[model samples]
Target: MQSVTLSLFRFGPLRARLWALSQMATARFALRAIPDIGTVKLCGSGVGEGFTPVPDTSVYAILATWPDHNAGRRAMFGTRVFRRYAEMADETLTIFLTPASARGRWDGQTPFTPQDITLDGPVAALTRATVRLRSAGRFWKQEPAISRAIGKDPNVLFKVGIGELPLVRQATFSIWPDTQTMAAFARADGPHADAIREVREGKLFREDLYARFRVDAVEGTWGGVMPDLTRRPTSMTNQMKVAAE
Candidate 1:
């Protein structure tokens, strides 16, 4: 599947309201077009320190997929439906669209395992709590540590960096088994805790954190142009052969 990361950057006082309005507009447009186009599986938003590593304002993220890159681009940038909402975005909006280069070990459809657990509760409960922390700009700093910890867990799946969309700062795209695993990592009293504390103690941001999530239905070309699932090869040749005219 192809994925696009849209990051909205805003500062000053009215950042939160403006960001919310823009997302609302985008969601409305997405919902209306779902029937004609592919599904908009997941959308997420969060808060983070700007490029300077200091809490800036807010960053919004949306994870959308389509049968192919061409369709996805049309749904997002080509139509006036999304454009109406795009106008509401802050002056400094930045967007990046990248394909899932390679599928991870746990990338495809599969049941989540115990390693997905972040807390000893229901998935919904954990997702809510972790989302709160993310909105507070707590999870951004601890990403590396969190990734390392999850990597050690055998149940954990592959980690892919979809590339960052520069706006308020750097925002990335990653897929997890479920919100439950994500919560366990965020709520743990580890590096994530320290990161959260930094935000709570300091009046770092001007508004609440923002994020959205959607499950994706992926299709289309694999290998060659995309990263290899097995390993990063030194070089890859096009596998699709053209027919004689």
Candidate 2:
């Protein structure tokens, strides 16, 4: 079976670099039009007004499903559609993952199918939620501090926030070297734990879905330049408002 890939792009923060979601509709349309494309989504980040206070207008992302590895690679690395996004941003990062377990629905259907993996490697996680209007404030209240904690945690390989709607619908995608490390960051003492508790107690979201996957590859660049994916970005300080829309 062909593996799935999730390509991310974070552009440089320049006033001239700002581009709204509406303007990119054509690009999103073009990608879906690709014959091999499966489940594809375009999202905005919440580093600004939506959730996290600190943000960058330049950052945006792409999540895609393909028929196979070759199909994904052909579109992302070779197609004109992908090139336009890369050229517009000052920085961009993309990673590919193989699903290990997926449950629940996304837009009514499960977009990712779990696949058996017989290898030892890194792990990736995705959390999606539809926030209830009444609880939106409380949910966002915990984001800034938690985001900072994740950004500072050495165990985290990389993570990003992306969503269909600013605060009402949100999702996070993160990678960890191992499950132990991932749990360490999400455990009792941290901001993550606090947020988890509030959600359970307060019923913050009307719906949610989470999944784990096996790492396939972490490649590509950000800001017109490629950086080492094995380690944190050299300019990590600027990414403080790292959550998505």
Candidate 1 Cα outliers beyond 4 Å, as residue runs = 1-16, 19-26, 29-37, 41-44, 49-58, 91-245
RMSD of candidate 2 to the truth, in angstroms, is 7.4
Q: Scored by Cα lDDT, where does model 1 land?
A: 0.36
Candidate 1 local lDDT, 112-133, one digit each (tens): 1112112221111111112233
Q: Compared to the true structure, candidate 2 yields what TM-score?
A: 0.81
lDDT of 2 by residue, 1-245 (tens): 64677766666555424554444566677887887888887777766322453344666778888765656766765677788777766666767667887776777778887887742556788888888998877777777887777778777766777777776877888878877777677784977888888888998888877888776655666545553343334333223222110
The most accurate candidate by TM-score is 2
**lDDT of residue 155 for candidate 1:** 33
- TM-scores, all candidates, are 0.35, 0.81
> In order, what lDDT does every prediction score?
0.36, 0.69
